[model samples]
Target: MQQIDIDNHHLNFQLELQYARARQRQRRRNIILIVFAIMSIFYVFIQPNQYGNKQNQIQYSQTNGTNGAINITETNSTLLQIQKHFEILEKLLISQFQGKWTDTQLTSNELAEANFYKTSYQNRFQIQLHLKLIEGQFLEDYYNQFSFYLNSSQLVLPLEDNNFVFENVRGSYRRSSVYENDQSSLEIFANLTMRLNNINMDSDTQDDIGIELDVRYTLDSETFSFNCNLNIINIDSKAIIYSTIVSVLGVIQFISCLKLMKDFINENRMASQFSLIIFVFLMIYDGYLGIVHFFLALQSEYFLTPAFLELVLFFFLELKLAKHIWQERFINLQDNLNLRRELYRFHLKFYLLAIVVVLLLYYLIYYNVFLIAMNLYLLPQIIHVAYKGQYVEFDKIFVFGLLSTRLFIPIYYRGCPYNILHAQVSYLTVTIIILLFAAQVVLYYYQCKIGPRFFLPKWLRPKSHEYFIEQPIDGECAICISQLTEMPTESQLDNKFIAKIISQNQNKLMETPCGHHFHSICLTKWMNVKLNCPTCRSVLPPLI
Candidate 1:
């Protein structure tokens, strides 16, 4: 009965140990699953907010005259409208000056009598016109003064000269010498120039000349030109702030990456170290571009052209770096040199393709399209990498954080016009990222709890049970396979074991170049004979 009880007790102990291990494994798995679920939910709910925020930003940019808001189609439409109005005004001016008047047109007598010019020198007309007849009121400032010289008659009549006058006009104008030599043309030009110039000379003079009729009958019939001058001061201010903030953040990220790389190097984690180097280079490049853009923005209101190009480069570099980091952190753990090389080449090709796409979009579609596409592409890649369990290193987490921060910039810029929409979206996306990071931290803590094993601290390994055995082998060492004739006493065994094997164990045990163990005497002889491990034939360490 006592023997049966002992056997049962042993069986129960084994079962308890097994149960504990199973429980530990289950707990670890459950924690991982929970963290993954949280992250998935966060991404699913937050992604819509990202898209909505971007869309709101686009709408705001368009409505508020921001650089990226207006689409190429809309901008082209505006340009066409201005061009059409300009063409109409050009036609009207030609008809009025040439005196080609139908019932719908004004005759040369009517035009001259309307004071379209200040004076007429022979055929040369010096028109100082306060003609309010211009159709497009948006072009009033440009058409405020006029000077017409007839090149056909070699006549020079300087009617009015101002900074914004005809002297600044670089383009060709029709010249007529007949007007200068002919009395009818001279009288007509003089009458037109005087009438146009007299209207705004004085209020009293305008009233005496019946200004309302002159303005209505003469000036009102003339066409007006349109010119658009977009003020970029506000955009410039915002861009400076944006670029500065991004650059500072980029620099901080780069520094953090460098520190992480140093840590990897210290741990002899070559793969992570290499991956971090790529990220560091990319971040430095981005920082440089940001600084350059900040300076450029100060000089020109529309610096986004060059800034967008930099952004394209940044996107490509960021993608390549991210892929390399992910691969280093999670995949291909066999130290597969070929796989690493292939991944590098693949990412290089991908970056090249991304660059081409960005350029094509900028040239063919719209400049702002590059920014949108970059964020869109990056967000997916980040989420995909995260979902794949690809981020083992903290550097990768930091990189993802920086990438996530980029989403906020467009949101802030969009807030200028669609404040409510951007605010809600920003709040949602931020909340999701925060929750996801928190879940990750919890998962990491649990992982550490489950297994505290680390790559370092060789001395901290559990001492082998064989080391405490009282009986020493009387025959040849199991590893050396040499004959032993003399047997030492227990005290001698203890002294030799402690002194020759343990204290001087570093020299007695040969560690191969690959870090596998071997008896030194046997390994040295084997290396001399074969230059490889006796057991595995892996390259042996060099003799001292």
Candidate 2:
């Protein structure tokens, strides 16, 4: 046998060794990103604006311990409380949407206050070229406030019937385990049928029908919001355009999710969970769309067709993911947990909150930075991938789907010449936004191919896991029992064939920390069943 030129072994696999355990750190980073994503999403969902960090306690009539029951008087009292809540909610809604015309007269005190505000602003803010930038900012607010105050008093929107006919009100009661007797919370919900008179504003007559109020209240916080959805009255082109755009985006998003789901159909445990969570997120979005369309239908008779059709489609559309999750959990049961029913319930709960958000923040339809923010959401993921120094199986479909979904609404309103709102957007701004999106996508693509840290200097990258394994030392292979000291002739050892084997087997050979060497494929097969070396029985680190 010809002695192998082990010293001169310049095979690609021999040049650098990548340990599987190091990949685990990359996976751990991925996990942290997932958790951060979840928590950020949840925070947005709850939107708990902690009011001055103050907690108010409310007393509820105690449930009888003997029977776990409530008193009739207590129930009636709760109804009275809900009625009072509705009255308060009605007042709050009137303040937000009730726009005042320039012709409207201000109260004597209000006029006096406006005059004082103007005089104070003029005295404080002399327009000099001085650099009090932060202080100068307040001048704009003051001027705008004075101007608005002079332009209006209250619009004085009255109720349709002037009575609290609360059609529905339900509440969930939870007592704090730590302070069960003293601190309890009541999350109350109410549905009321009501309409405000005279909603026309700025010479733009918008005939709105009755509004649907979904009030959320916490007795402990003494906080409540009308959180109502105002029905669109007349069938208009804008409504049609907006609905169509959203529906089309949903189709794109759903299709991409299905494509991603395809990657999860295998026996990979982590992949299954990630895919399921993504599917659940889609369900939540579907629920939000359902709310939006439902409101659209309520606002216009012409919109009823699109609205109902969407719902019908959604009914069937959910089946695809539902069936996938079901099969994964029951038919082809794997150890990776898939709580299908729980996830469905989770989506439902989020869907309910989404409806509340849509109602309360209908201004988001026209946008308030939220739409633009969506396009930049990938920044966090991009940063995470770079920090992890790994390519974690991202795909083009999902990336572009997210980009398209986020950009569609904004692009339609800003880019379309014949937009329903007839708003003129700067063509340059739209172009810049598109270019920015393109740049981000390109950077991400580059990262996926040549590691996430491609932008970072090469020396900073982790090289500890990598070792020059093809040292000029003679050794014997434990698994193949081949002469590690021999190098065959070009015809016998074919460079192309050697490279193919290395690629297929991750690495042609692996070096254990305890000075053991084996064929990479052979060691991998062993690690799947046990974590000890075949020859040394030394504890082997697990692969990522």
Candidate 3:
């Protein structure tokens, strides 16, 4: 019987070892499957949505030389290319028009004047210039002088045809003159004006806009160069008024973002602080674009690099912020650890894809999809808040407000025409948000200064004496079983004074209706978990 029992025990031990090994193998297989699943999802989603060939490709080629020749070739949107062609056409027409003005001048005189009839349809402009160029710096000096002139220049278009206008036109000029390489080139830069539309006018057009252009013919080369950086600006008076309002609102929004960032920092919310910092940067970039749009002559393309950087930064911030919200709200969900690990992997892939998108697609509108995706990721948190009927975090409120500013208001202006309704809706939304923010600030201050009782209405305020007592029945608290009269010897106050406060004001003692007393802090902590008196197990109202 003993030998049979030993053999049975050996069999049982071998079976148990086999079962343990099988379980370990199963766990490893599950881990492998999870990793494979995460990678597969990443490849499927992230790989397919790469920037396609539809974007404008900018390439640079340099030849081997001391003064390397740089060539830029692009396969871009035909529409944009056509737009550039039209701009070149307008420039050619303007140059021809100015040549017409030059023809009427005396070619022999060092100083001559050309006067043209002011066609009723078009503006009659005079060209005059005083030129002095130093030796060995003809090209650069002439370009610099002309660039300065274009900065102050403005285009006035006829009411009928407003296309092909350049305002705040400024840039370096490309010179193809015989005098370009000369020791000195005395060239006077001149402005050109022409009537592009209604060349065949009925009964002679009336209003006239005049320009004065001065040019000096150089001896080294009998040629000159003229060009302006073309950026369209067609803001009407109504649009200007609306833009002013939008600017004011943008300032307010920036202020609000900064305040929230400060709060996040103070509260030690690192993730939130990082997100708000990005928001502040984005607002500042928008402000810069706004200035370039409405007040400056710089081309929108000039700001593309910074704008692209901002877009990439924004996507990164959104990813981080989404992950932060998810972890905070989804801690109770099953498989949370695996979900968080996968989330990091997904976000890493997304960050790479976002950089690619911003580089390939310069349009800011493309990034709107990212914002939508971020919000979708946060939908669970939104739903949870809705179910609980609680206030959202202030960061969320600020984010939505900023998004509205971008989506509803034409904050960048960009010369796109907008109706009065756009202005009205933007103004209303921003005003309401500002008011709400102000109220929240006030409430937060009130909460900090006053106690928790102030959170409830006067009628709902619980009578403290019913649950609190001036003295403990025993020397120790019934809940913690610690001496209630124990005081810290912090050298700032007398022990007697501390004892007097505890005795007279029921300082640290709280008594339940069941006639048992506990430390106020201990009882409150206990009630938070189980809304009942610890000593008697009696039901009580939940702590607010």
Candidate 4:
């Protein structure tokens, strides 16, 4: 009678083990299916921002004219529109001039007017400039005052200084170096003597004539020498470079977010949706920013307003992303309701304070404050992780990349005050992150084992039975009715385990605090989803 009972028990155990394995397989399939569905939905709904931007451009052009100029109404005069264009051109010229020139750089708001034209060969470039009057009101005739032209040729000019006398203007140009391509720099110094016929050349009467001007530029001296360190990169080439990098990052992060979404859905984790939403917003903003850069490169005046708006949006989104990330750490611990509530309450207060800061302060100050807050919030987590000395999570690596640069750069800049080293360090850190993220994307795509393994220290490598809870007595799992350590050969179950399942206890099973033993895979999945013991529905203790 005892042998018969034992045989029946073994048969039932075998059936239960098969069922548990089958359930895990089904769950995996369901997860994959859900992920696919979500991806499809995003594809359908979240069209790339560029497409809409293009459509808007087309509609705008059609509405305005074939020439793509804005139609001015009585309220919006042509002069007002012209003034707006001049303002944008002034900013661009000032920025480019200050960045490239070495001599007699434009003082703040000193560039009165600027325009550029490309020759038929496309290699020849001409830039026109007019300096702002020091005294007297800017008049409609201001456009006619002190016009100067800078010319560059694709043909490399001789590296010698020479004096040339044109019909109306006499000048000396020294071509020290020529810009060969987008990657190269151009160094040239030029001085010109302008015969200002429109201006009353008399020094005392210059203001009366509506012209305040210094007409002579010297090649040998700094008078009228607009410092020349011109590295002329085409806007299109710059746009391509920036757009390519941003596009690559956007694609990789989009994939990462999709993976995260899948995990959240599979585990039925709703608490982290706020973070996901912020992440999505950031991705959208990044896409729009890239589009803005491309349009700006094309010299589209229409996108200028949008570009500033995008910058402000980026600042806000970055702050929100940090906030959501901080909130998610605690809320993700589904078992700890009290802790989650406290964290949520804290986050609410922080958010209100942040809003006040955002409203009261400028974006630069807000950016610095956001960085400081992020570092402060992440410091405790970093310390905890270091103290625990456990496996380094994949998300932690991502967060580290995001926060580390922000944390150190601001501190360095604060101490040093606008040092060139700050810029170099920022660039170096960004380049490293880009390379690492690219590598991460490729490794993740290939399912490389080394991706996660290399990030963790040897001591932190998981041990056998690390996740398996030993129970006082053995029984079937309520989630998956599988017998534990009661078999003719425990090793026989090894082949049935899924890829994620670690058969750590010599093919033995896991147990919960409630005393029910289960297949390690079954209990782990159940605990991950609900944080409860399967049989008695008791909240499980938090794992390290």
Q: lDDT by residue for model 4 over 117-207, one digit each (tens)?
A: 2212133223344332211122111111234443322101121112111122322232211111112222223334221122222221121
Clashing residue pairs for model 2: 4-485, 4-486, 4-487, 7-472
* Tens digits of per-residue lDDT for model 2, 325-360: 545434332332465565576558756765665564
For candidate 3, report its TM-score. Answer: 0.30
Number of backbone clashes in candidate 1: 21
The per-prediction tally of clashing pairs is 21, 4, 9, 3
Q: Could you give the candidate ranking by TM-score, starting with the highest? A: 2, 4, 3, 1
lDDT of each: 0.35, 0.42, 0.37, 0.37
Worst 10 residues of 4 by lDDT: 57-66
Model 3, span 1-544: residue lDDT tens? 9999999999899799979986896686567546644644454345431112224322211121212222224235533443332332322221111111222233221111112211111132212221122112212122122321221123323212423333322222323222344233233323333234323222222122223343332224454432222221222444456556555555555555555545444643333112222433353345344433322212112222333323332333332344454443333445747876766865576556546544433454223233233222222333332222222233444545444454333322211213322111123233444454445444433432343234557675544435555654556666667777753222232224233334444354676777776776566545533345676666565333
lDDT of 1 by residue, 446-479 (tens): 3223322232254754432221123233344334
TM-score of each: 0.30, 0.39, 0.30, 0.37
Which runs in model 4 stand beyond 4 Å of their true positions?
1-95, 98-259, 266-474, 482-502, 506-521, 524-531, 536-544
Q: Candidate 3 local accuracy as lDDT?
A: 0.37
Lowest-lDDT window of 10 residues in candidate 2?
126-135
Model 2 Cα shift for residue 16 (angstroms) = 47
How far residue 71's Cα lies from its native spot in candidate 4, in Å, is 42
Give the worst 10-residue stretch by lDDT in candidate 3.
112-121
Best by lDDT: 2
How far residue 344's Cα lies from its native spot in candidate 4, in Å, is: 6.2
